[model samples]
Target: MKKTAQPGIEARKNLDFGLDANTPKYWHSNDPFKTRLHDALQSTFPEGERYFIACVRVFNDRIEDPKLQHEVKEFIHQEAQHGMAHTKYNQLLAQQGMPMKRLLAFHKDKTQKDQKRFSPEFNLALTAAFEHFTALLADAYFSNKETTAGMDPKMKALFAWHAIEEMEHRSVAFNVMKSIAKVGYFKRSCAMVYATWMVMYFMFSFADNMLEADGFSKWQRRKMFFKNLNWMYGYKGILSSFTPSLLRYFKPSFHPEEIPVIHNYPDWVKAYDESGNPHKACEALIAAAH
Candidate 1:
């Protein structure tokens, strides 16, 4: 497969989301399910992104294209910045009694073992699969305003900003797999299955734990879990629109850039650059979808 065109990926090393104790327990529209769903993903990022970086970096020496090589470096920088920003944001959730460290330990231990047992090629394929998952999420989110309605501005901005970069560099790991690691259709496809299972298992598990901490009983939590699933896959649900794109990964010709994204990244960047306010950046992004 040929290398797809890459948009520039920059590390916005200093943007701040103003996370603090004043932030509410349910920052996503004041709903426990929405808030914890995002928080669950945030809880995984610091360690998971490090794993992504390591997986891609192992093949850096073999990347021959100058453009892709530069993208790889910027990709490292961007993912590192993402990890740091999420770490700080996750700390705010921890202070709210979310059991952040304990939840994080589960993913961390699993990652360590994967590193020990998996080949670098397999890890890179896994990273590519996860990156595709994130890109799918970013595309679904920034495209639809309903998904983010009434979310706290600070939290929304943090996620919108992260989503912007997720779309921007969505292809880096896949490029590494295709161009350098030479991962085939079978390995990448299998990795997507594993990645999908891990995402489903961990995201739901983390959200369930958060609800339990919120004093919901088993029966209530069980009901809430189905509600959350419908919210994701129901008609016009957050992820409902991405079913086709998700399946597109199994195609032999799939590439990240082939997926169209409606988020106005250029305007969002311009807004953030001029004002240095994440909320304004998010506003610009949302407005552009019309």
Candidate 2:
């Protein structure tokens, strides 16, 4: 696999989103199923990202390359910011009566258990697996115009900014794993399978719980399930779109940077720059709305 020049990672602060009562119950494409799916994923971030940071942190002293060490610091900063930002979003979900508290507790407990049961190398491999998942999803978000077309502008910006940054630092954890002598193809592949199963199981489970909490009728719930399933696995769905990239992980020589991203940072730098203050921008937008 030919490697392209990697984008630099920076940990920008003060990112904010316009989340409130006015924000739709189904924020993603105004579809209840999609919205719940995203809500479930957001609920995972607070705990999940911290795990990623910690997994990479375990190997920090072992990494001899100065450049990689710097990237590790930035990766920690970025993941911390991601956790904080998603915590706020998850709070909004709780405020709106979603089952965020219970779901969050479940995720936190799961992470804690994994930390105790898994070796540092396995944990880091899992982190790399998830990073690949996010990078692939980010690529899909940018390539698929319909993905964000019906979203609230502020919410769209929030997710888009995250996708761009995910792509930017996608290789950090993978590289860190590579630096460790014990990490190898077998462990990485097993981690990918385990990570994918766990993520999908939790995500759909939480989505189902959220939909139930929202008071959807039995028939409506049934209808929405198929809709979401079709949207995820049907022809031209996310499963089809991401499968190729996801499969690349099984290859002995696979690397995160090997997967091509559909969008580039230069196109999004103005609105979501590494140095810009998104919090102030969000505040100004809210103030103007009144």
Candidate 3:
């Protein structure tokens, strides 16, 4: 794969949001299924991102490319910010009686166990696979404007900010892996399969738990299930559109740069800044924890 010039990837400190009582229970278009789906993913980030950080950091000394070395540092900072930001969001969910703490604990335990069980190379492979998934989802978010159009403004900005960063550093782990190792196709492919299964499993598990806690009726659950299914797999679904890129991960010679870049990423950054400086948004949370 040829080296393509990438946009600057830096950690913007204090990138926090004002998520308070006003934030709706169903912030994603008032749909329980959609909202819970995002909640599930958010619940995973605190621990999952830390795992990504550790996996990438393990190879930092082995990186010979100066640019990639810097990118790795930026990636670490960005992931740390993401984890902190989402940790705050999960607290907000707990305030809303969403059982976020329990769910997060489950995720944290799983990630810890994986860290203990897996080798550094295997963990790095997992991180690369997971990064690919995030990049694909980021593309989906940007491609489908309606997904953001109906979201609560604060929530939308939060996700948009994350998506933009995800896009910016999508290739960092892949590049690091390629630089340090011989790019084992089998290992990468297997890691992606395992990562995909674990992600889907946890995402749905969290979503289901949230829905049950919200007292969704059987009929409501049935209705929302199909609605979400359609939204995910139907004609205009995000995942449907993402199929091509997702399949590319299976290729022996696949590199993250091979995925097309989001052309209007500058717009995403602007939206995030205008919504609120992430650093400023987290001031209270930072202080309270001290």
Off by over 4 Å in 1: 1-6
Candidate 2 backbone overlaps, count: 0
Alpha-carbon shift of residue 228 in model 2 (angstroms) = 2.9
- 2 or 3: which has the higher TM-score? 2
Model 2 is weakest, by summed lDDT over 10 consecutive residues, at 281-290
Ranking by TM-score: 1, 2, 3
lDDT of 2 by residue, 64-133 (tens): 9999889889888888888888888888888899878788998899998998899999999999999899
TM per model?
0.95, 0.91, 0.90
**What lDDT score is found at residue 31 in candidate 1?**
79
User: Judged by lDDT relative to the true structure, which candidate is superior, 1 or 2?
Assistant: 1
* lDDT of every model, 2 decimals: 0.85, 0.79, 0.79
Which residue pairs in model 1 clash with each other?
Answer: none
Top-TM-score candidate index = 1
